[model samples]
Target: MKAWEIQESFGISHLVQVERPDPTPGPYEVVVKMTAMSLNYRDLMMVTGRYNPRQPLPLVPLSDGVGEVISVGAEVTQVQPGDRVAGCFFEHWTCGKPSREALKSSQGGPADGMLMTHKIIHENGVVHVPAYLSDEEAATLPCAAVTAWNALFTEGNLRPGETVLCLGTGGVSVFAAQLALAVGARPIVTSSSDEKLTKLQALGISAGDCINYRNTPDWEESVLSLTDGVGVDHILEVGGAGTLEKSLACVRFGGNIYQIGILAGVTKDMSVIPILRNRVRVQGIYVGDRQSFDAMNAGIAQTKIQPVIDRVFDFEEAPEAFTHIEAAAHVGKICIRV
Candidate 1:
């Protein structure tokens, strides 16, 4: 088997594609023959040693991938050989409240992740991919999509006819838009690139729903104006501290704010007065548990939604994938065909 390993010296240049002995699954484990993998901002942080400088070296990178079950352990009964599936972002968190043990099982960080030719996964840690999505599309789901679903459906209790604000056109934001549309909720997307906003518009988002954050730095006003000054029912807060205050402004009184990323700056000086005065709710959304992933897949299967992929790189171009994500030029998901 071949895998991309993040060497001791971090950065994309240190990512080496190397050979490894084929893995044999333990009891209750399954062997996945990876067909496609997707990149995330966290992957870039890991590669650059920005998130955890002391993260163990020579680690397999990337947590999102869709593969076929090539073999299963004797006790594995959840999936059979040839079933297409994607690894759960958390190998141990099945459902409900997460614990330290469950959180520790997450890939692309504390644990070895996807991004290899053949990887071992716990039988319960992989789910059947939606039939509507191709391998490339399914490869984008394990982290970003699940996190979006957790923020909206699981935590926000989002309803149709409600307005939602998407912070950017990254993977999670795009997935939020897709899921919002699937449930008949309206999505307003913001992007610095007018071209990226156009991509969202092409996907059935209303012409007036796209906002160019670069042109209008105070874009929260645009969101409020769109809602007739009531503000949106929910805001997907992927921008972190840099935009948290703006998000607090854009959300309606008592509306939910799903904190999913820190793309803008990890730490910022901000007041909590708005949250207190408006009676707003802010929920931190991690990539969800297996139960959430299953529910999301069921909804996606029903809606027949296909995740938007900005580009796909060949397996050999893994290093370039990291570079591409670091550039932040893509409108949606960037995948690698394994």
Candidate 2:
């Protein structure tokens, strides 16, 4: 088997491809022949040593992948050999609320990830992919899509005809917009690039009037104007500290804010007055559990929601794919065909 491993706590440059022995499954585990994997901002942070202080060196660095089960261990019945399955980014949280133990069990961090020809995952962590989606599309589901589902449906409780706001055109935001539309909610997406906004509008995503945040600076005013002075029912806050205040300004009174990413930097300082006055509920979302992953797959199957894949790279070009994500050059999920 071939895999990319980080032998030191360095940047993406430290990722090296090497040959390794194929893994065998444990009593409750399954070995998957990886078909595809996707990139996320967290993958870059892991390589740069910016997230998860507990992450050890010599790690595999990806959380999203789809593969075919080639082997299964004893006592495994959830899935069988040759099933098309996608592993949860956080492998231990199968259902309900996440525990401290579940939080500690993550892929592409301290534990090995899916940047390999084969991966052995606990049987409990693997969920069957939607039959309608391709390997490239299913590869995008484990992290970005699941995070969006958790933000809008699980935590935000976003209802049909309600208005939702997404911060940018990145993978999570794009998935958030798509999920909102699937459930009949209106999506207001913001981006610094009007070109990308135009593309978003072409997708039948109403765009709810986009803001060129780079130009407007105080883009929340535009959001207010678009909502006719009422604010959005839910705001997917992916910019972290940089956009927290703006998110506070744009969410409706008694609305929910899903703070899910730190793309703009980690430390955040913002006023609590708006939260207090509006009675806003802010939930910090880690990528969701396996039950949510299964529910999301069902939703995708029902709605036939197509995941937006910006580009696909061959397995040998995995390093370049990581570089492209690091440079923020792609639109949606970037996948590696293994």
lDDT of 2 by residue, 285-328 (tens): 99999999999888889999888888999998887888888877
User: Which runs of model 1 end up more than 4 angstroms from their true locations?
Assistant: none
How many residue pairs clash (N, CA or C atoms closer than 3 angstroms) in each of the candidate models, in the order given? 0, 0
lDDT of 1 at 155: 91
Give all candidates' CA lDDT scores.
0.92, 0.89
lDDT of candidate 2 at residue 50, scale 0 to 100: 81
lDDT at 202 for candidate 1? Answer: 80
Q: Which ten residues in a row have the lowest lDDT in candidate 1?
A: 106-115
- List clashing residue pairs in candidate 1: none
Extract clashing residue pairs from model 2. none
